[model samples]
Target: MGEVLVLTAAAGVPDAAAAGVAGRATRLAPGAIEVALDRPLPAGFAVPGVDANVVPAERRRKRLLIADMDSTIIGVECIDELADFAGVKAEVAAITERAMRGELDFEAALDARVALLAGLPESVLGECYAERVRLNPGARTLVRTMAALGAETALISGGFSYFTGRVAADAGFARNQANTLLVEGGRLTGRVARPILGRAAKLAALEAITAERGIGVADAIAVGDGANDLDMVRAAGIGVAYHAKPALAAEADARLEHSDLTALLALQGIAADAWVD
Candidate 1:
C-alpha cells in the first residue's frame, strides 16, 4: 500500500476526487476521510477549514503522545493570564506573542514577563487557573482515548508547572512536566526556577519518554502551537501544529486549522465511534 491521505474538516467531509486525489476512500468519522493513495495530492492543493496529511498506513497509530499545554491543550496562555491578575496583561501578552512567533528567546521573554508580575499575590495562580483557563474542545477525549488504547500520554510545556499539573490531570495525561515559578512570602518572586524548560527540554522529554517506553521516536506523536514546540514537533513521527504560530505551522507534518483535538485521533485512523468522550 502507498501512503494514506487523511482529511479532516471541522464541518463536513471533503471530497477527495475534487482535489484530484484518487484512492479507496474510507470514512473515519463524520468529517474525516482516509484514502489509500498511489500518488500524492497536487501541489498547493487545499480545502478551506480542512486539515490534510499523508502518512504510511502501517505507522498511522502512534504509541506515545507528547503535547504542549498553553495555547495547545488549554485555550489560554497561563503566563498571560497570570499577568492579567497583576494588571500587566497587555505588556506581558505582547512579549508572549513575540516569543511564540520565534522572534524572542524563550527564556528571556519568560523572564521579562514574569518580572512584570512581581509582587502579585501567589493566590492568583489558583484564581487564574480556575477563572481563565479551559481545555480546548476535544482535548480530554483525545488524551483519554489515546491512553485507553495503552499509549503513554504526556503534557510538556515551557509554561509553569502549576498549570501543567492541573491541565494534565483534567485532560487525562499519564505524566506532565514544565518550568516552575518561584514564590516567596506569599508573593511572586518574579523568577522562574533555574534551568528552565524550553524548546530543548520539550524535545528531551520526548526522547526520554520514548526511550523509557522502549520505542523509537518514530513511535510517538507530538502536537503544539508555538515556536518553543518546534524541536519536539519535528522529532516526533507525526508532528501536528494545532492552531499554531506560523513558524511551527510551517514545519509540522499536519496542521489542525479548523478541527478540534479529536482530529488527531482521526489522523491516526481511529474512528469517531471509538473516541473516548
Candidate 2:
C-alpha cells in the first residue's frame, strides 16, 4: 500500500464532501498519509489502511492541565451572568463580546464592564454564581480523566475569583487564580484589585503551577477560548481553542470544533469511550 496523506481544511473550513475524498484516499497506508488541508478535518474520522500508531504524531502525554473558565470549562462567561444580575447585560456583554473576540483592549473592556456593576447588591454575585453558571458538557469527564492519569489541573482565568473558586471546586482543579472584585457595604465598589489577572497573569499561573510541581512546561496543556488567553495558550506544550473566536482559533495549535471537552482526550491518544461519564 502507498502512504496516505492526511488532509484538513483551513482553520474555519470543514467540508464533509472533501473529507469523503480524503477518506477514499485512505486506501493508502494511513501512517504514510500526511493531512495537508486549509481547515479543520472531521472529528473522529481516521483514514483507513493507516496505522493508528503512526497517524497522530503530536501525541500529548500531559502532566498538567491549565484551563480557562469562561466559555471553556463552563458554557457562558461568568462575568456576563454577573452583568445579567445588574440588568446591564446589554451594555457589559457588548464590551465582553468584543474583548473575548480580541477586538478590544482586555483591561480597558474589563474596567468598563466592572464600572457598570457599581452599586449592584453584593447578593447579586451569589445569585449569578449559584444559579447561572454551569459546567460545559463533558467538562467533568475531561478533568477526571486527566486527574486519573496523575495530571495536575489548574484553572487560570482573566475572570474574577468570585466565580473561578467555585468553578475550580466543581470542575476539580487543583489550583485556580483570577482577579478579585472589590465590594463594600454589600454593594459592588466598581473596582477590581490591582495587578489584574489578564493574559500575562494566565501565563504566570502556568509557570507557577509547573514550578511548584517540578514538572517541565512540555508536560503541560492549556485550553482557552478568548484573546486574553493567547499568551499562555502559546506557552503550553499543547494548546487548544475550544469553540473559540476566529482569531483564537487561527492561533491555536489544535481546536475542538464538532464535539465537547472530551474531544480533547483524542489528541492525547485517549479515546472518550474509555473514560467514565
Candidate 3:
C-alpha cells in the first residue's frame, strides 16, 4: 500500500527538520507536512517536537468522525466538577486520575466516584454546565469542517448525556452518545443507569455508527484521552491520543502532544484556510 508521513507542530515545523525523512513533501499548513513516501518511513524516524503519522493514502481522509467528550472535547472532567459541587473533589479526582491513567478499572471507578455524589442536588448539573464546562480549543472547527464535507460527526463520551447533548449541539456533531445519570426529586439517586457505557460501549458505538454510515472502523478517526477510550481509539482507522494518558498515548497510532484538536484536521489534510466556520 502507499504511504505518507504527516509531521505537524503548533509552533511550526521547519524545512531543516524535514531533512533525511523519506517522501516527496508538501506543506499541509504552516505547521504540518504531507510526505508522499517512496518507501515506508523508518522505524523510530521522528522529528524532535512534531506529531507524526505514517498513514496509508486511502486512509488519509476519514468519512466518519467519532470523538470522546469530557476531557477530549470539554476542558474539565464532568464527574470531577460534580465532585467539587458535592465537596468531594479531592477524593473523586484521585480516582479519576487513576482511572484515566489505566491504574484502576473504569467501570468500578466511575461507580465509586458517582457514589460520592450521592444526594447532591440535581441543580448542580445545570450549575456545572453553566459555570465550569468549556469546550476545548479547535473543537468546533473539527466538527464543522467534517460535517460541512458530508462526513458524519458523533460525540460519544463516558460522561453523562447531560453534558454531551449540549456539547454536541454547540460543537456541531450530528449525533451524541453517553451514559445516563439517574436523578430523583432534584437530587442525585447515588446511582447511574445500569450497563454503564465503559470501554466496550465506546467500541460498540463506533461500530454501530460506522455500520450506519456504510463504512468500516478504518473509515473513521477517533480521538480521546482516557483508558476507557482505548478500544475505540485502537479500533478506528486513525486513532489519536489527544493530550492523552500514558497508556493511551503509548499505544495510539497518532499523538497530539503539541497541537490542539484542530491538529486532527491537519492530519486528515484539511488546511486552516479551508476549515468551515
Task: Put down candidate 1 lDDT per residue, 1-277, tens digits, no spaces.
Answer: 5688888877867565235677788888877888888777778877767777787788889999999999999999999999888899999999999999999999999999989989989999999999999999889999999999999999999999999999999999999999899999999899999999999999999999999999999999999999999999999999999999999999999988888888899889999888888
Better of 2 and 3 by TM-score: 3
TM-score of each: 0.96, 0.80, 0.94
Per-prediction RMSD in angstroms? Answer: 1.4, 6.7, 1.5
Winning model by TM-score: 1
Candidates ranked, most accurate by lDDT first: 1, 3, 2
Best by lDDT: 1
* Clashing residue pairs for model 3: none
* lDDT of candidate 1 at residue 224, scale 0 to 100: 99
Shift of residue 243 alpha carbon in model 1, Å: 0.9
* Per-model CA lDDT versus the true structure: 0.91, 0.74, 0.88
Cα lDDT of model 3 by residue, 11-64, tens digit? 887877668877788887787878888987678887888887777777678898
What lDDT, from 0 to 1, does candidate 1 have? 0.91
